[model samples]
Target: MTTFTLEPQDNGRLQSLCGAFDEHLKLIEKEFNLNISRNNFTFTIKSNEENPKSHHEKLIQCAIKLIQDLYMETAPIKGKAKELELQNVHMALQERRMLSQVEPERAKSDVYSSVIKTKRGVIKPRGVNQVQYLHNILTHDISFGIGPAGTGKTFLAVAAAVEALERQEIRRVLLTRPAVEAGEKLGFLPGDLGQKIEPYLRPLYDALFEMLGFERVQKLMERNVIEIAPLAYMRGRTLNDSFIILDESQNTTVEQM
Candidate 1:
């Protein structure tokens, strides 16, 4: 069991952080498989004791830190503590922790200070690795970002693609992913090729939607300025004047690449 208290907790900010009826806490608990109980500003997080240095413990700590950060910013709590926000919190915490373990000089460097412009606003890299990743994307013809889940790999890639398209740097944007199922058989799914494959490509669409807005993304798709498809669809085609993003490339076979 881990216990901590939030400092200078205003009732309104606390309410916003936890959401109405403690929905935010419940969401975090569900995701981390932990029990969270609150008594005013004090919070108790309990998890399986058999495993020391557990991921659940880390997640709980990150959640608490995120709550404190938001409280300090006086950010609106309503609709703020969603799955996406939690995911970002997890990523930020993971990056910060990892960077802290590395060389202090590298951790302090402002390499990722460049901002990526989008229709929504400027997208900045949250950490040193992300900064290097964006710099590579900008300078190199081909770049790869390989990392475990909860990192901003896909999100940053989509942001770069959107930025390029918006600046007229690329005539079109191509997003592709392998239509491979995890354990379930794809043959069991109903619908045509496009519909059946759409589920696999949803993450790309989601990132694009966040940066470009849904209506604008749809309009661009209609005009073929933005193209998304299964990797298999690109077999005989010659792509030109395009900023292409291949997500979930690990799921693709050798021939697909």
Candidate 2:
């Protein structure tokens, strides 16, 4: 166990540092397997093992450094302290290479240990590689899940997106794919943007409907909270605060990419 004090901490800064219900601190603790209790500016980090391994010590130091870095980032902005979001905390840790290098091998023994929670249920990785893939989705801004068909790659990706949306981590979910017709030649289709391209993006829709239910999905689509569009529709607009999925990327040309 060790104690560290963030110097000259202000109350507002502390709130931003800890996040809502100390969620940010909780994330750090989970990542490093440490218990953090705080008194104003002072914090105590307690590990489960009394005498932690050398790598564990290194992780502790890394956690402390990350806390210090995040604290530094909480400095007042134009006379007001900026609120630090979960994504901000994640970005800070990723910048330090903490998430990538610190996840231990033994963490994967339970395939369901690191799971994505959705309203429907928990999504578990089927194998070691899938476990790493889920972790990548967690710790990276964008991830590509490449695998053979029926390997849960597409389903898991959609599950993660649904979980993110349900958690309010993102404002919207936008799914897109190339619309190269395989066998059918439909001369004309009359409908909204999403309806026109529904066939091409049906797989993505199926996953969303399963997670969010049919009526809710329809309501979200009406509100533009969930969008289904062809890849060509993405050219002129910027997507922010949204989980965007580009499915069937193999069919895209260099220009489309």
Candidate 3:
């Protein structure tokens, strides 16, 4: 059995860590395949196995670390401890998966420093890759985010672009993606070049519209401040003082790129 007591325990912080009816603790128990029991701020952890495996120590350590991390999060930010949610617990656990690979100090700094506030609310990176990706975009003039879908590659880029435009660091924002079909063939599709390509660039536009609002995004597009650059039409364009985003650039041919 592994046991530990949370230090300098405050009722609110302990409550936040364990969650309502100890749901957070239950989640940890489920995730780590362990049984957890608590008496006040003190907790015990034991493997569910009839006999603990050799690697059970490592497993217990990971569980303890997660609990400690969650407890740290419960520290009062303004005056009240940040309430623990299931989602927050999941993200904290996911983000720490890279703890061995990434330097903790740097990752923590990058995450807090690159917070992106939009029309919706403040946006923070979920994991290590995202933290590093945002840091790269903020630091480098020409930065590329290569990641799988739903990894916030385009979302973070749009956030950075909107922030730059809002700060007057860039004149305008230009969004583009190679109009390559993933499953559906393009020739069979209806409408003009713009109409057809709009579907390809919809993700970029959605991110923009979410951050800037529909009316504001439309006004910007109308004034040519925010442009959707089809791969074919971008050959002769002289873009200066702009935040140009080339989403799905991998689909572009070498000549087009």
Winning candidate number (TM-score): 3
Q: lDDT per residue, candidate 1, 1-257, as tens digits?
A: 87888877567667756766777677666656678899999998888456756576776775666555544443333324222244444554555566567676765565533567764654667767787898889878999999986688989998988888888889999998877765546776699777788887778889989888899999999999999988878889988888988887888888877
The TM-score of candidate 2 is: 0.54
**Candidate 2 ranges with C-alpha deviation above 4 Å:** 1-112, 181-196
lDDT of 3 by residue, 1-257 (tens): 99999987889989988888889888888877899999998999999999898888877988997798677766664477767788888877676666446665764464534567555444667766788788888888899888788889999999988988888889988888777766667887689876787777878988988878899899998998888877777888888999888887888898887
Top candidate on lDDT is 3
Worst 10 residues of 1 by lDDT: 75-84
Report per-prediction Cα RMSD to one decimal.
10.1, 11.6, 7.3
**What order do candidates take by lDDT, descending?**
3, 2, 1
> Better model by lDDT, 2 or 3?
3
Better of 2 and 3 by TM-score: 3
Q: lDDT (CA) for every model shown? A: 0.74, 0.76, 0.80
Clashes of 3: 0
TM-score of every model versus the real structure: 0.59, 0.54, 0.64
- Model 1 lDDT, residue 25, Cα: 71
